[model samples]
Target: MKRIGAFLLTGAFLLMNVAVMAQCSLCTKTAQQLGEGPAKGLNNGILMLALTPLVIIGFLAFRWWKSNKEA
Candidate 1:
């Protein structure tokens, strides 16, 4: 039913968020291991900032498309 679909969607979103967090942690660890703590953090910050727009756009597009789809 609709409830099940909604639950699945929420779960999928949660899982995706967790995956991204895991990847971010891995990136941080790799940078630290390479002896570039400060540099790595800055690099990550810069990367995130640079990708912010793309992420936003993608999310917006996805939401727009999803909302328009018929059940």
Candidate 2:
């Protein structure tokens, strides 16, 4: 039951997509003026930044699970 609940919670979080408003008006304006290349780079950078913490958490969770399973 606990595993099922955790699976559902994780699935919900993964499926959720919230619209993120631009944080800096000046930066946004500059990116737009610079054209598609800079805009794409900015988007990729944001995604990489956002994924870093999730990746760390996931690795820690996997380690914890493995340790608990062994014991």
Candidate 3:
């Protein structure tokens, strides 16, 4: 039951999407002026930046879970 609850919670978190406007006015203006290539690069950079902390936290959580399971 605890495992099922945890799975549902994690699934809900993974599926939830929040619309966030992370760009400042200057950045938006620059991207608009730079054409498609630069705009794509900027977007990829933003995604990498955004995902880095989540990836780190997920890794740490996985490690903690493994350790707890062994005990």
- RMSD versus native structure for model 3: 3.5
lDDT of each: 0.70, 0.81, 0.84
lDDT of 2 by residue, 23-71 (tens): 3678678779989798767766777788899899999999998999999
What lDDT is obtained when candidate 1 is compared to the true structure? 0.70
Q: What's the TM for model 2?
A: 0.54
Better of 2 and 3 by TM-score: 3
lDDT of 1 by residue, 32-61 (tens): 677756655656676688788978998999
Q: Write the per-residue lDDT of candidate 3 for residues 1-71, one digit (tens) a residue.
A: 99899999989987988645456789779988999789768867887798999899999999998999999
| Total clashing pairs for each candidate | 0, 0, 0
TM-score of each candidate structure, all chains considered together: 0.39, 0.54, 0.57
lDDT, candidate 2, at 21: 42
Q: Which ten residues in a row have the lowest lDDT in candidate 2?
A: 18-27
Superposed model 2: Cα runs more than 4 Å off: 1-30
- What is the full ranking by lDDT, best candidate first? 3, 2, 1
